[model samples]
Target chain A: MKTYLLKWWQTIRISWSKYTAYRLNFFLQVVGPFLVFFFIKYNLWSSIYGEDTGQLIRGYNFDEMMQYHVWTLVISLLGQGYAAMNLSEDIRLGRISSYLIYPFEFWEFHTAGFLSFQILQIFVSSVTLGLAIFFGFLDLPSTMTLLHGFSFTFFMGFFWFTMQYFTGLLAFWLEETWIMRVLLSIVVSFLSGYIFPLELYPEWLVSGLKFTPFPYMSYFPAKIFMGVETNFMMGYAVLAFWMAVFAFVNHLIWKKGMRLYTAAGM
Target chain B: MSNKVIEVTNLTKQFKSYKKKPGIKGSIQSFFNREYTTKKAVHDFNLEINKGEIIGLLGPNGAGKTTLMKMFTGIIVPSAGELTINGHRPWERKKDFKKKIALVMGQKSQLWWDIPAMDSFLLLQKFYELSDQEFKTRLDYMAELLGVVDLLHVHVRKLSLGERMKMELMASLLHNPDVIFLDEPTIGLDLVAQENIREFVLDFHKKNGTTIIITSHYMADVQALCKRLVLIFDGTKAYDGPLEKFEKILGNEKTVSFSFSEEIGGCDFIDKYDAKWNECRNHVDIRVPEEELREVSKKILDLYPVIEFNTEKMPIERVMKTLMTNPEVLRQQRENLSS
Candidate 1:
């Protein structure tokens, strides 16, 4: 256990160095996308609420809706991409052989790499949040809400990581996973409340999304921060279940995939 | 605690690759009726490696050197037969099994491309569960030997290929693995770098008694480090024995090259000796038996005003070309010689 922890810590240190190596690129990556989305969300929401100041669309006032947009944007900026892409690239290009010779397991190594990346993301998100507050685009949440929101957001981020990992593992069999990548983007954007609030969707659409893990990644965390009544335990339960499912499936796929790997091109 | 660290018997790995037809209709037809061909990458291979031995795996491209190495390293499973490294089934992939082995692929890198070499070394140290003192001692020793102690902080991407390869060696050896697998470790290095790596490998093995297996296109690497050679051709073992024994079977042939002081028309002596002439360099080469090298040189000197004359072992490229084209004749020669 101590060895594993040491390995994880070293992974973070290495990844942190890589993240900070290109300081200009790292800062621009976060700031550039955050600015673009902030303006778009702010403009779209202002146009909607400008025509009807008294309208209570989906139980959100103008201030509350703006708050949702800011936090949601923050969470999206800090989100992890499908690491399976890296995994697949490694396998297809024969780099996986290097890892196979090591004492560490494949999934564990990639997971440590992903975790290290998120550690950097969390740091970036904090800086972005500070920027948002300074720019007068976001008001600080209450102490209690901040605690609940961070906890939920952490699990939400993990859930998304697992899902992305599971989806990326398809590269073990399929040579090309771009279609799946595109599909994931469409599904997450439409269902994870990244583009719009889940409350804006119809009753049937919301009901269908409840069966998936997308909304737990973005919507519930935002709703919890607003101090709105959410089924916190239930959301946690679903996230935990998906995490378990993805873990088991990933293990099986890895075992089976090891047999299929050709380590092409030496 | 056997002296033999690796043992294999009848090991074979077969890869199934499907043919891709051209155009949409061909693709559809092929998809429906997939024509998969089974490529036998490693065919009934057998090997036994002892402690403190450096063995060279020699072969042409796509001749199963890398595949066999992959199987030994537990990257891919063999379709049939048995393999054991350090008394562990390679495909089982036990942590203890992996802890004892290191693989350095020349075409690929294990270091983090965007991070400093030191960072990758630190991660490897933790992954190998080494104490800080042990890690530091090993890293310092290897870095000093490879002359990369100061370059450790430089990003791997920014380093030269040879520099990165040095770091790779340091990273692989930090844990003192019992068995080291090197696949073309000197692929793209200059002569000086290659010799440095060769000397380092010899020094490291001398100190540590690590069993080593290396594959390379450069014969200098094989000649410098490996006493034993495993020659594979067409995905099968063509020859396995000491380097001296294999050379003896090829009749101890040497390439004798000559350069005349002035360009001359083709001489009857050249035709009589069946020499190959390079008109551009005013050079001529003749194949001579090792026993007759002195006589041949003397005769050539007497005939022509020779400015330069040298005798070299048959080039490994030529050796491999002959082996690939006439495996049966080589095998017969070996059998006859042994008998």
Candidate 2:
């Protein structure tokens, strides 16, 4: 058990070194997206609200809408920041052959890498949250609310990771998986209310999303941070169910894919 | 008890690929109704390698050398038949099986390119569950032998190819595996680098008595290291024997080249020996039977103004070239011998 833990710890250390190898690139990759996305959303919403700061669209004034967007950015950085780009590339290029030869399993190495990336993402999200609070874009929530929001978002991160891993495993058959990832991101952004609050959508559409995991992914967590939604049991139960489903599906895909993997370009 | 580290019986691997034509029309057609073809990359191969033996696997390109190595190392599963390495079914990929074997591919870099090699080595040390003392001792010994202690801390991408290759060798050997598979470990390097790698491998194998299987297009690697040769042709074993026996496969004839001071007319005596003359007739190469080599050389010296004369240095190289150019010759020879 100790040796296994050491393997994981050592892999995580190596992954951190790889991630921070290029200081400039690391900085840009982590913080750049949050800034750019927040900037765009801030301007777009400001234009939509148009010289009427008192206008309320679905129980949110301009200030509250901006605060909600800020929380969405934080949730995104914390929960959905990791991607399986390297995993797919490794499969497509046959770089995973070395892992097969090692005593460590391939999934163990990649999960260790994800854990290291999560550490970096947590740091980045904390700084983003601090900035948003300092810039008056967000107000401080109660201690319990903060705890619930962070705990749920971190749980959602694992679900996101499993889904990405499923797509990455498709590299055994598909020539390119980035298109799938892009499509997933767009769908999540629209359905999870990352672009706009779910309250602004039609009642039927909001109710339909409640049956899926999309709302709990971003909208529910953002509401938690904003102190408007306090129901954590249903969100946890729904996310857990989806997570189990993805985990099982990802396992099946990996088993089938390994049989078809020719280790091309080795 | 018999001492065999690797055993195989009728092992085979087949690859399936879709045939697609060129241009947009072909692509559209392939997308709708693809024609899949199954190729037997390795077919009914059988071999038994004894412990602590170095075997050279020689074949032409696309002859399934890499595929065989991948299967041996458990990177890919075999389509059929049985194979066992170190008493474990390699394709099962048990942790104990993985720990007992190592594979190095010269065409690929296993080291993490973004970080220093030391970091990667440390990670491997943990993965292999090596004691700190053992890891350090092995690292120091390999670093001193390869003369790359200073380059270990540098990023792998920044190092020269030769330097990186040395690091790769060190990384693979850190676990002191029982069997090692080398797939062209010295390709695309300078002569000195190649010799260095060969020397290091010989030293390592001598000290450790590890079973090694190597594949290379450069016969120098084969000549310098392997005492046994296994030839593969079109995904099947063609020859398996001692190196000396393989060198004499075609015939026991020695190729002797001579250069005269001035052009001279070829005599019937020289023509009787299958002599090939240069344009000016001042240089000629003759094939002489082993028994008549001494008599023929003396006669040539006495008959012509022989400026320089020498026999071929590497007989296996010549044999390999002949076999690669006309593989049918080997098949014919095998048939004739069998008959």
Candidate 3:
């Protein structure tokens, strides 16, 4: 157990240093694109609500609607873009062979590396939030709301990471997974409420989506920060269930994938 | 470890792959009716590698040298037959089994590319659960031996290929594995760099008595490190014995060259010897059996005042070329091995 933790710690340190080696590239890849994306969403939301100060569409005043989008940006930065691409690339190129001979498992190494990247992004996300507050474009949530929302979003991050890993495991059979990545991006954006809020959808659709893991990804945590009505217990339960399901599926895929890898020299 | 560290019997690996037809219609047809072929990468291979021996795996491309190495290192599973390294089944991939061996492939890097080599070494230390003192001692010793102590702090991508390869060796050796597998370790290196790597490997082997299996296209690597050779062809073992035996088994033709002080007054000697003349009229080369070397030299000297004359075995490249292209000789050798 001590050795496991030590290896993971070293993985984090080494991976973080690797990611930060190109400081400019890190900012451009992580910060620049997301900032542009957020602005585009901001403009689209503004156009929808119009210039009126009293606009309240779907129980969200203009300020609250913009805040929802801001939180989506935060959640996207904190919880999305898992290590699927790198994982799939390694599998496809047979580079994973080099690591298979090592004492540690492949998934553990990648998970620790992904966690390291996300941990650094947490600091980046905080700075973005601080800048938003300073610009008078955002309001801080209450202490109780902050605690609940953070814990929810943190767990959701891991849930999303597992889902991404599940997608990456398809590379053992598929030569290229860019199509799957594209499909995943579209599904995540539409279902996770990154494109719009669950309230904007039909009542049946909203009820159905609540049963899925999507709302817990962007809507639940962002709502807590918006001081909107929320079912924290229900959110936690759904996220945990889906996380367990994904984890089980990821493990199955990993077992079968390793067999195929060893058999065929992938 | 016992003397017999590695044993294999009728080990085989066959890869199943589909052939893609060209064009859009063919692509659709392939999706519907893909034709799969099973190419045997390693076929009925058998060997026994003793401890503390350097064996060269020699073969043409696609002859399953790398496949066999991968099987030995536990990176790939054999489709059939039994294989044991240090009495452990390779496909089990036990952590203890892995701790006893290390593999280095010239085409692939195990080091983190963007980070300093030292950082990767530290991660490996943790992976192997090496104590801080043990890790530092091995790392320092290997780094100094390879003359790479200063390059360890530089990013791997920024270092030259030779420097990076040295670091790779250091990383693999830090835990002092009992077995090492090197696949094309000297590929794409200059003469000096290749010699340096070869010398380091020799020194390391002499000191530690580790069992090593290396595959290289460079004969110099084979000549410098390995006394025994295992030659495979067409996915099967063709010959396994001392390196010198390869010359006797494959072919026995020796080249005898003669350089004269002045051009021969007459060209009649060429007809008697069937010699090929160099562009300069003074030099001639004749191929003869090893037993006729003295007779051929005496005859040549009777005709001309030889400034210099020499007899040497055929170059390894020529032998390999003949072996790779001719199926008849390879089949005969395989039959010999079986018998």
Ranking by TM-score: 2, 3, 1
What's each prediction's TM-score?
Answer: 0.94, 0.98, 0.94
- Candidate 1 stretches with Cα past 4 Å from truth are A78-85, A135-138, B262-272, B277-283, B302-304, B313-317, B334-339
Q: At residue A145, give the lDDT of candidate 3.
A: 83
| Colliding pairs, model 2 | none
Provide the RMSD of all predictions against the true structure, rounded to 1 decimal.
2.4, 1.3, 2.4
lDDT order, best first, reads 2, 3, 1
Please write out the lDDT profile of model 1 over residues A147-219, one tens digit for every residue.
7888888777777777777777777787667788888878888788877889899999899878678887778
Judging by TM-score against the true structure, name the best candidate. 2
Task: Report the C-alpha lDDT of model 2 over A1-266, residue by residue, as the tens digit.
Answer: 99999999998889988989999998887678667856798889999999997899899899999989988998988899654668998998999899999999988888888888888888888888888888788778889999989999999898888888888888988968899989999999999999889997999999988878999888999989888888889999998998899889988988888899889999
CAPRI rating of model 3: medium
lDDT, candidate 2, B91-164, per-residue tens: 88999999889999899999999999999999999999999999999999999999999999999999999999
Better of 1 and 3 by lDDT: 3
List the candidate 3 regions with Cα displacement exceeding 4 Å: A262-266, B251-253, B265-274, B291-314, B333-339
Q: Candidates' DockQ values? A: 0.81, 0.92, 0.68
Give one digit per residue, the lDDT tens place, for model 1 in B54-137.
999998888999999999988888999999998999888899998999999888889889988888888899999999999998
Interface RMSD of each: 1.0, 0.6, 2.1
**What's the true lDDT of residue B295 in model 2?**
98
